[model samples]
Target chain A: MEKSKTNPNKDFYGKTLMGIEIFVRSLIEENVDVVFGCPGNAVLGIFDALLEISGIKIILARHEFGAVLSASGYARATGKPGVVVASSGPGASNLVTGIADANMDSVPLVIFTAQVPTKLIGNETFQEVDIVGITRPITKHNFLVTKIEELTSTIKSAFHIATTGRPGPVLVDLPRDILAEKFTFDYPEKVNLRGYNPIYSAHSGQIKRAAEIINNSLRPVIIAGGGVTISNAFGELRELARKINSPVATTLMGQGVYPEDDQLSLGMIGMHGTWYANNAVNESDCVIAIGSRLDERVTGDFNKFAPKAKKIHIDIDPSSISKNIKADVPIVGDVKDALKKLIPLVKNLNNEEWLSQIKKWKNEHPLKYKSTDKVSVPFVIEKLRDLTGANAVIVTDVGQFQMWTAQFFKFLYPRTHITSGGLGTMGFSLPASIGVAITVKDRPVISINGNRGFQINLQELATVTAYNLPIKILIFNDGHIDITRQWQELQWRKKFDEILIDSSCPDFIKIADAYGIQSFRVEMANEVEPTLKKALALKDKPVLIEFKTIYEENIFPYIPLGGSVSDIIEH
Target chain B: MRHTISILVENKFGVLTRIAGLFSAKGYNIESISVGPTEDPSISRMTIVTNGDDDQIEQIIKHLNKLIDILKVVDLTNEPFVERELALIKVKVNPYTRGDVIEISDIFRAKVVDIGPTTLTVEVTGKSDKITAMINMLAPYGIVELARTGVVALKREFKGEVYTSKEIKLIKKKSRQKQVEDDEKG
Candidate 1:
């Protein structure tokens, strides 16, 4: 509706609205359903504007870090760009880790941060930080809106840049003065960035060449990554794998992109990957790496990673194609598009002997763990996965619990398993689980975290209780950073250093109780399942179940640093 | 393993920072970088010289192309391109070496832009190698100060599509109108 009385250009303008209102309206135009925010003095006007908006919901996080992590989780789970807002200075600085994580993982997010008034910006005013400068490297793109005229357009550009191409976090630093200023509310329908054009389809010639390579190779293994999930190429990945009679191995980030329970699945392939997965990748004649950057954790030693294989890397980001491992056939396009084109050109292969060899390797060195007298983290993860089944969304924090969850959980679907794979951010689980729970309200959302990791953002418990989110928080309390200690023990001649956490770690059950969340602690093996079940049964409120796991327990099937895939320590 | 890359980008705020940040974050050492406005006021071109192996340079080009403000990235190191650097050198010129300095500047086709009692400022614009050679020849006269504008490069012949300012503006406007119409229909 045009407000001709107040508007100079009736055809191009609408009713005059506050800059804050325009910002919120632009987000709504982008189809953002929820915004995770922690309000401060600079963002009060925006908060006031948000209260009047009926269609969008704002989830108030206790900390700015919690807000961004939750938004990242929501983005990964829903396949939509997550939105977050925070006040100036410390609030914006607090978002650095989450922003970096989102960028590293290629999760789409649009972050709005409050800035000090434009006049007070460079005078060293209170609550003023060069947020744009700080986040320049981490964010895909960012804006510092100094003028009211640039507010809506900047917000629109931020959203477009965040969700397109290689999706990553984008920030818009809104000055407090602009938030209070009045402006015409004209949301741009589309952003036309001349520089940002992403290739969605593969070249037919390259696809044909890739198919020929796959069809000719008797020992071919497919290595899928987060790109597969991001592009929704799981179906295509499966079709291609089935056609070529190839076993599929996934990177940690690509865990759920292919069903782990499938006969052709080779679990995960990396440092902590299963023996068979590593062996299959090492022994393969051809390696089809889709949507993966081949990070150091996955590659072990770049010189020897898939050495014998003729590698084919298909990714949306061309920079990721040969950054770590050189690809013979580099298809710079979306994984789904590349796979779709490739499947048609590939003929069904009879690699029964190669498959049998892989099966023998799997039988010889399956994922093994001893069930000790005390409760173990991996055992709990397996039992929890069994109880929750394949429908539950699993989120994890970094460290030992993260690796254990990745190893034990059998994800049958994409977007069902969420973790900070690239950034390896600790304290991501609890808040991220809150986000996943919000996105998929009907499914069970479980967060598996270590004690050291969970306490990084323990304040998020308040947000979970405030929203009455039914997120099941499972804390594996080993009393210290278990993975670091394990590494020190193995590599540094058992000289335990700063890896041990101080005894001053908070009483987690009491901490959860303080936040009005249902809390439980289990130490015995028999009590684990019942505790998990009890936590899962609660429908109206969030629950925290802490298991006192063995402190010295180490994750096995580890490939030593700088070692090849074949040099695995399977203890 | 030196590579020359020419980047065409929108003349937007923070575009330089984004490009520089990408290079540093990815661990590519920039040997030299020069940014200046193109013929169109709305567009800027950046010439970056960096040292990396073939794969690293390719990755750098690809990464540069990924930036939202970058329109085009041309790695001219492998192409037939002409590159030039401008340097202003002030040399301490005594009576004995003043004639020698003037002779050297004359031989190199450099101009003496400024003269002080004991120093002569020589301005030289040539290929990077020539400029370096000139500086070395003037070093015998005891150089006092030096400032150099990093390399600016261009291909001898146009090989890619070049967008005029009007065409770019028109394309931007048309795309926006189409998007607005689509939104209204939806």
Candidate 2:
């Protein structure tokens, strides 16, 4: 609760401070509570400055990738800009995947990477790399800070750019000398970038046109995306849906935007989405897509996706409006503001026949999985959700388990279901879960990862135990990359190739023990519920539970690549 | 179709590279690019020429506008505009060909800026087509080297207001209200 003596009012204006300390103080001024990163040779000065900081907590991950992923998770959960730091050369290079993942998912992160001294840069110094050049394409904006005078302003600009208008990752590469240099700690109170204004309110003319279209259409569907959650417009979205009497469908990334328990909510739509949701999109006369780019996974074929419907696209990013599919009515603005403008102008519609047809499809296909004595992934996900209730945060890695968790786990609130839907990174769950635990201390955090994917960043077990975070790590041990095996079985005649990881995989329980965390392995169906209960009950420390699931089990109701959503193969 | 886009950006290091990197990474080809400082020393204007369909050009403009350093982007192809390019051509010539080259330059309204014993450098500023024609006419003398200043453009007179003054006032008011709401939330 102690405040820094060097407040922004007087003492901090012209007071001399190390560039590193000024940077840390700027983070404090921005109300950043925690940062995730690993230290290296070039960033020793920064770590030294952080050592004396009282308010900020730094979670040290075993790897740079883990640090960045954890920062991404923190950003997604808290709706704040996550801060991450890394060293020069390979350390900075290691953060590329996580940075790109965050960019694809529109998570706001301010990444700081150390560089070799300004003189040694471009001369192949021991740990020097052109990190700014390397990350230019992935970052929303980046800077290579060489002057001490520009340090504070650059950091401020980086945070502003990262958290504003269609948020994404921004990087600031600081040379060693810059961090070690002495300068006046003057942090700017406001950002005045003339070129960086974002349109937040929808144009009245466009909103009126959209309402007219909605009123005229016989059957309409509202397809919401991650923007709904990003803008915190779920309440407005639900209100607009009810006003128009339209069924709502969400993209895979848009899962938690609309409550799955609602009567009008058609679960996720697209590849691995619900049958009724896909059918509803294909059959509707008007499709109102808000904040989603309509990626290939969501729209099977660009030309065929919602072919019969008059599509209206609304988004904050102007490029995403008609980049993939042409929009009949394009409104460029923030989703929350656009929905607020639209709610009053739109009138109700009587689509009873359309709703009944969608109801029939939901009853017919209804996301079924084969019942067996062996433990199944979907069953475990359902049981976990039931036992944990809807309040717990669920994060999953990419694979069959991600889809199963997306399908079976009914999320009733926003920010509760976090996954890497865009970049589809494999080793994201564990570190991200640690981040979620840091942000939402009151809620239980559950991380689900497949065996092969979990081993990618298993070193984070040390981080989990170091913080003693009460996160429950659930590993679905399918003995291989089950999604790949499923593809080979259906298309390649079960050649199998090198997908098997049964023999080479380490004993997860022993691995957990090595990290000083409690571990459990459940092989039978009867033991699954009891073991999960035990894992969730451990509130003092972290626990890892490995569920031995059926190896050959495949996700059902999958729409093959390049296939139409209406042509889903449900087995 | 070929499109010409003019962008105003902050005069800062790596701004050009960032814009160029975006085009190359997205597989968009740039025919020519020219940048220079405006009356405001803190800002620079860049003119880029590229060929793409209507949709592709819209996307290019959108991406260009997304850069934080960029102040504004306008596609000259979408409006009635005046465009010009400047070129300096160094032509290898002998005494016999010198007279003919000078005559051709005179016909094209180009001036001879530099003259050597073996080469004559002609300076021409006009529409891109005129510059191209001048270069072609002097090419018969075995051109030694050539440099071009790409293309710079500006829209003609205002046709009318794209958005009514009333609408503009409403837009400004709405944006201000939204900002106040955001500040309240923060």
Candidate 3:
């Protein structure tokens, strides 16, 4: 059953240059439309090969981290394997965080990092790092190319593994010697990695059991997780929900899985989840959790979460099933395939008592805010939602504003909401939104940022303007790391509350102007929408709309640690 | 709401640790756990006692079976099955009341593996209830040591393969189609 390597034609031959040609050729043949990365000395040979190639657009990012994050955005938007290249050492190290972020969130990415020449390895060579060793814990798998001809198959396998089965990041580290070597290239027809097989087919017995449980339960709810979004199972999820006539609650990453305005949709649920979403979970007697791990954010106080509900967890990764919260039934397969089987079997689940109970809870504690003449964050988010018709792609950096966006913005489609949920990586909004804006050329892509989160990766602003991307960055300038300072002040009695900053900040409008992009400042509630519209009206280059507002604002509907969703703090 | 789950899996390296880590990482409470090799060398049986309802037990079973090396999982909480636990408890016994403990162990058919003037170790394998009954019987003699392997079970005559999602779908589809026809006629 194994392919014998006794055949001379199949043996790997030659040096680095031939390997580079073969590897780059395989990527081209796979129809990879773009690659985002920053090159260095070790990767110069590959760059030379890339120079001769056309049709694949290479985005030169300001930093390797920015490139990988942008690729992450592209992957999330298109369900494609995002590819990024980096030089040895520093270049490879820069990609570690982004690759880890993709791994944590299960985003498909093929990251190529150059290594020192094979002869110089383990000799403390210049610009060298043990990239493969360092990336073991973060990547699903990695490759170290020792042979020249193995390059094509290795790259092919990397792509295959990255995109298939519970997709995650994979690293392909090619040494300078391998890149300079010459070898005849032949792509492998199939992958046969022993012990690495991923199941794609749905097991019918489990589906029927899930259906039976759903039909028999008095109060049933469906909790959609990031798996649904990753699988592009929005239609399937909606169909199954409609068939069951069930209300749907989602994790932070599951925001765009369904139209937020749908009657059965309960919106995003977690630490700062909506009151209706959290309470709906509490009221359900049965929960059909598809593509979500039911993490701490989704299931606060694990013992008390969904106390009355039996869970049926559907996920592609077997490791996720009942790993956190218990499941009444577990279906280990692709979400799309599993849902396809469950759709026809789904029955009308009528629990009027449960429905009305959730409705009452929703009425008692809806997502509400009070705004004065000074301006409110929620009011700005509401205005943006209204201005964009709730249709624009929203990319958010982590902070108080990200939670506020989730609370206020009405997302109407899958992949329309993009953010680093699991990693919570700051400064992800601008570059990610720029990448999304490039592909979604006509539609507006808004990068919602906080003052602190924006400061982390503000250098990408130059990249945005250089590409002439029409990305609108709405900066919520609270003049501090408001979330942390608020936590320290609230929890620590403001002791050593040296966290708050009252100093005047750099004018973001002036910063954008320096980058050859449009800028506007909204210091009041009335000016928010008008400034936002001005930015959205731009056709070329990027725009920044800075909201100079109250700095002490905190995201409410907070679920204290070890507390249930019903214990939300309204303030 | 406590249940005993019996898992039959391949006796592969790291299987036990993987299962334990899974529960610990999820913050799931493991009330008690017992595992041992079965009559077949290639297969091992694990008995896990957890606190949860019927729904929770089902989830554990479904997830356990999903592990690549796991052959089957059976929730023997309510099913007609025979369950047992083996615990080699070392009791800190003195010269006094030593005979009473030996007499009690003999009554329960438990063998004394080692004996000392100050300590006595007993090896006993029986149903969890039987073990508890024996422990109660020996409690009066001033027992000092305690160790237990969680409960493991096997259905006396049950024979079938684990049902998967694919099979579940066909059953429901047929039933639904039948229901539609019945409704139309009615």
Candidate 4:
């Protein structure tokens, strides 16, 4: 066996590969199988290398946001950092909302953007935007590739950081000059990012302290946050909860972190959260907030949120400790790692009395909705969930319907429930659903959206049909932003401005028909399940089911910020 | 509840804009913000006052620190810090009250350097409370102009090092690598 003329010098060997090739090869090595992007002059080199690759398919999206959304959907589905590539300036700027959504949701994603040549960067060359700076707050970390030598390490670091503790989006901004430059590619053995030191394992002492706090409490409630899902610690969380016999209440983003059918599960808590879940949080002696920041939506009134409880916050982000609703015991590490450290230290005491008390609270304050003469959104969501067998992915746009879907649907698996919880970006559901459907071709994915949210991104309907995806869009067509409209009706006495759409939106049924997809509208309450079943029954192309809804509907169990979730104002 | 926080961050591109975007997206009202590079070459300090609860304020700080450019967040409200707010108040003073105003400025330890025929410009540097007190006393004299540098603070025992996020990161990285090396050699 002859090893032909290997370069004796390490530096000489490494100096042979181009930076773009190094970055591309690094991504492939990280098990990245696909990239969503559109190429331009700045990123022509990368596109050339990406073209030669046979396994990693590159999906050319019409818009940068669409590509990023598809990447986000991919991240949610696979629990790996999804990748999106875009050219400089407008292309990068368009990815802002998608990146912001990932930041807010803590979804793992990698966005690669081309910049103007290094020489023209400060000179404001054409199509040059400070993408790294643009994406700072919306990213876990970011890099500006200044040299060809840094490209390989930068890509590796970005992947490591993005998929690690408290996963979020990361951007690698490449200047055109660097991409055009030639350098040898040697994949870095390890990343050496200066400021990023993520602790994946919990400190044993802190974990023990947390366990002691949990053991000593009477009414202990596990306030599961998005962290559980991010860490893939559902099994551990379930075991710990079962060991302690404590009920688990989730934040909106915390859906699917625990099995919905678990006996100890109390469902989502906060504004528009279930009564039992909120009551459990309020009445608990100890509030073990795992991976949640206790955002205003979750806390309701901050001062009063779980006021009586001794808070124990376990999060990877240090700032989250005592940042919101001060924690008595704060454990800074990954939720899974924290649980692993703490579980053994905790005494397996059965809090049967506390559990029974919570059960009573659940029985007394079952989520009550007024039986209006009109068809209800919850009824539609419930039927849809049943027809799809809870196996279908549920995507919701933010509003009354978003909350209602949370209330109605029970998610058993992680990533099954995808919603814009952080950014709460409207029109996100349909595009994201299309992404999910594309990724999971066999699963029946459905986007349950409000009429207004559906209108915001209805243009994606063309993309849906163009791709021949099997996703179904169920729109709660109330004709306006019902959540904001309800507040307007209540606070301003019918001075409605923001919620009302001036121009009538195109008929979704007609629009779907034009797109060559099956469409239906259900007005009567009895017609909802049948309509949903019909839509689900069709597996060839996407379907749209529009339910005629009342214009001004409000989500109930409403705790205005800084108030206890238990003290809800029903609409 | 309202909180005024000072954040020292690296003067990287899009950082301030990103911070502004975050505040807007989160629906937090940013009452005032002043940002510029400090004594350090690379770092910039941003003074932002937001209205919300203590918890909300802390959350804002945490989220702000999450930005790659942000070095550290100092809730100057709790710490022993020197806060200065510069205000250029152009008061429409008649000759009769001009002397009295100057005397008052002397009493308050303020400087009245720019003087016009009908108006006098008083530059004051003090804590927000101190500035507000002087402004109230000067208000009765029919003030024609008012411009204020909202608020800026520095820690009293300040080491004049650049407080960029990058520097802090470098320190952390160094320490972590050292630890790994130590573990390997242990």
The sequence of per-residue lDDT tens digits that candidate 3 reaches over residues A1-571 is 1234743223433323366777676776566778888878887666667767545677878888898999998888888888888999999999888888898888999999999988998788999998877776577767788878678777878888888888899898889888777776666778645335678887999999988988888878888988998888999999888877888888878988988888788888888898878877887788889898888877899988998888899988877777678778989899999999998887776667777877787778788887777767889999999988888889999888888888889788788888888888987887787668767865688899988788777889888877788888888887887777766765777776665673556778889888887788888888887887777777565778888878667778888777896677777
lDDT of 4 by residue, B139-161 (tens): 99988889988888776674746
Model 3, position B101, has a per-residue lDDT of 81
The C-alpha TM-scores of every prediction are: 0.93, 0.93, 0.76, 0.77
Where does model 2 sit among the CAPRI classes?
Answer: medium
For candidate 1, what is the DockQ-based docking class?
Answer: medium
Per-model clash counts, in order, read 0, 0, 30, 13
Poorly placed runs, candidate 1 (over 4 Å): A1-13, A497-499, B158-186
Candidate 1 residues B1-186, lDDT tens each? 988899999998889988888988888788889999999999999999999988888888888988888999999976677899999999999888899999999999999999988999999999888999999998877999999999999976745355546667988899999999999999
Per-residue lDDT tens digits for candidate 2, residues A1-571, read: 1345664334556789887888887777777788889989888777777778636798999999999999998998989999998999999999999999999999999999999989988999998889999989999989999899988888888889998899999999999888788998877877878999988888989999999999998889999999988899999999998888899999988988999998899988888999888888898899999999889899897888887899999999998989989999999999999999998988877688998888888888898788777789999888888997777899889899898888888788899888998999999999998889898888889999999889999999999999898889999897888787877877798776565555688899999989999999988888889988888888778999988889878887888888897568887
Error of 1 at A249 (Å): 0.9
- Cα deviation in Å at residue B116, candidate 1? 2.7
In CAPRI terms, model 3 is classed as incorrect
Task: Residues A432-524, candidate 1: write the lDDT tens digits.
Answer: 988888889878888888888888999898888888888888888878888888888889976766648647778988898788888999999
Per DockQ, what order, best first? 2, 1, 4, 3
Best by lDDT: 2
For model 1 chain B, give the 10-residue run with minimal summed lDDT: B158-167
> Which 10-residue span in candidate 2 chain A carries the lowest summed lDDT?
A1-10
Q: What DockQ, between 0 and 1, does each candidate earn?
A: 0.62, 0.62, 0.05, 0.21
Candidate that beats the other on lDDT, 1 or 3, i.e. the better one: 1
